[model samples]
Target chain A: MAQRAVKQERAVRTREALVQAAAEVFGELGFAGASVSKIADRAGLTLGAMYFHFKSKEELAREIVVTQPARVRPEHESEGLQHAIDITLTWAYGLAEDTVLYAGARLVMEQEQFNAPEENSHRQWTDIIACDLRAAQAGREVRRAVDVEAVARLVVNACTGAQMHSSIESGRADLPQRIEEMWRVVLPSVAVPSAVARLEFGQSRGRRV
Target chain B: MAQRAVKQERAVRTREALVQAAAEVFGELGFAGASVSKIADRAGLTLGAMYFHFKSKEELAREIVVTQPARVRPEHESEGLQHAIDITLTWAYGLAEDTVLYAGARLVMEQEQFNAPEENSHRQWTDIIACDLRAAQAGREVRRAVDVEAVARLVVNACTGAQMHSSIESGRADLPQRIEEMWRVVLPSVAVPSAVARLEFGQSRGRRV
Candidate 1:
């Protein structure tokens, strides 16, 4: 039983290494330009070992898409608009520094080549934000005139653009700042006056949240 | 002189065809994926003719980036916030249908591979919008608290993301609507109350501008 457990742990580690290497290659070369051999080499694993885990490049790319967001967990419990803000700010900061997240974003943007499912990270974020906004509306934190769905869509879309712009222009060094600026412009229109006053847009808050 | 004029017109036609074809190829294949021979074939021109106009593929991509924005001209003169809105809306609408502009946007996004200069379309838009916001500030169309440069960067970055999201999800069918929604969220924060009331977010207004 001890030997079996150790073998399983080793398998997990190898799989993780492959995923990390695949992400780096995919992020740099994109889907059409990336190759399995290159990914395996980058991971420092044999091609046979890579195939033992992921069957193809598309599967590797899909794994990155489905799994990257799960890595962003709120550090502390929050409610309503604060929760929504925490998610956005945390994601902005994560996207700037995390290799897997950055590559996942790039893959999601260029997923057209792979003929992947239409439901992607953007939709997931919209749903998540909309749920939070609904809670905020119930709490009277958000303005009554604001449409939860529309605001959620706008936030997700704007963040997507801001992150991409930062990635290209400044290597994502300014993503958090860009996202904060975006919220300053958007929060006034969506949140009630009191909620706007209470909400925090600081980088430290992102880490704590 | 008449014969010379006819020859010049034919040369111009050939150049336009080449640009259009290059845009289509580059938009679909990106910079590294695109080939000069394929571009020439798509243009329905001989390799010799393509070479005469553009010495290399990099030159062709550069031309697309430099020339695409010049096509987005407003129908009539407008100033301040109205002009800013017009440019954003018109660009959103144009991006959905125009082939060259779409290609240009893609090229600008994937320009890292080519080692191109950082001053691409997004920066250009930011500068243009900043100039307009300065005019708007002078005219009292914008609020006093709003930072013209920061807001301009936010607007451009948000639009970039919105257009890219629309392109990936709906083939850019919903870009104009997305831009309108973005303006709804942003305008309230940046524009004076009186200016907000007069701003048009309609699709028809985009065409007029």
Candidate 2:
């Protein structure tokens, strides 16, 4: 029993290291330019070990793209529209420096290169935001006439564009500010007046969350 | 002189054919995946001819990205807010079928692969839209308090995101509709109420333009 536990812990460490290494490689070289051997070398592991952890480069890319939402966990107590805003803010803040997050973002855009049919990070994010908007509508924080799916899609797409421009303009240093601006213009259209007045767009809100 | 004119016409045809072939190859297999030889073959032209027109794939891709704004020429007499809307609507409509337009859009996103520093297609679109917004503000079609740059950036970014999602979800068939939804939510915040009432989002508006 003790031997099995030790082996399992070692496997976990190897998997984490491989993921981090793959993120750096993908971030630097993009999906097509990155090689599995290069990723294994960067991770200080052998080709056999990398194969043991990830079956192929496509699988690793898919894993990174799908795991993007999991990185932006809102630990704060906000819910509904505020919660949705905080989630995006948190994501924008993390995107400035997080290797895994930014690499996943790049992969999500270049995913067609790898020919993975099941990869839909944008849809996943839209659904997550739609859920929050639905909750907000139920609580009356959002307007009755607001289209939840459309607004959710807007949030996802706008954020994607904002980050793309931000990456080019400032290396993502001003991403949080861009997200704030997006919310400022969009909230008035979808949220109740009181909710709009009370919502926060601060970097600190994202950080604290 | 007639012989020289014939030579010039042949040169122009060669350049146009090369550009069209490059767009198709880039559209099919992204930048890194595309090759100069394949492009030359697709165009049914010699390698020497392609080099005479475009020195490299990066140069070709830059031309495509920089000329994206030129593709959305607003031929209509709508001089202010309406002109800006028509430009985007026209672009979204074109993205569905225009190989050059969609390929340019893709290259703009994946441009980091080619190492060109001067590619700022988003900035170009933002500036173009900002120009129209300034004109609209002067005409009292837009609100005095509206930040022209910010709104322009939003329009560019939201359209980028909207087309990306539309491409993924529906192969861009619904991109014009997505752009309309974007304007529907954003116009109330920037345009005067009267202008909002008058502005059109129909496919015919794009077609007419």
lDDT of 1 by residue, A64-110 (tens): 88786686766767888888888888877787667788888788667
Q: Which candidate number would show the highest lDDT if scored against the true structure?
A: 2
Interface RMSD of each: 1.8, 1.9
What docking tier does model 2 reach?
A: medium
lDDT of 1 by residue, B153-207 (tens): 8888778777767777887888888888877887888888988898876776577
Residue A173 local lDDT, model 1? 82
Please compute DockQ, using alpha carbons, for every candidate against the native two-chain complex: 0.62, 0.59
TM-score of each: 0.92, 0.94
Q: Candidate 1, A143: how far from true, in Å?
A: 0.8
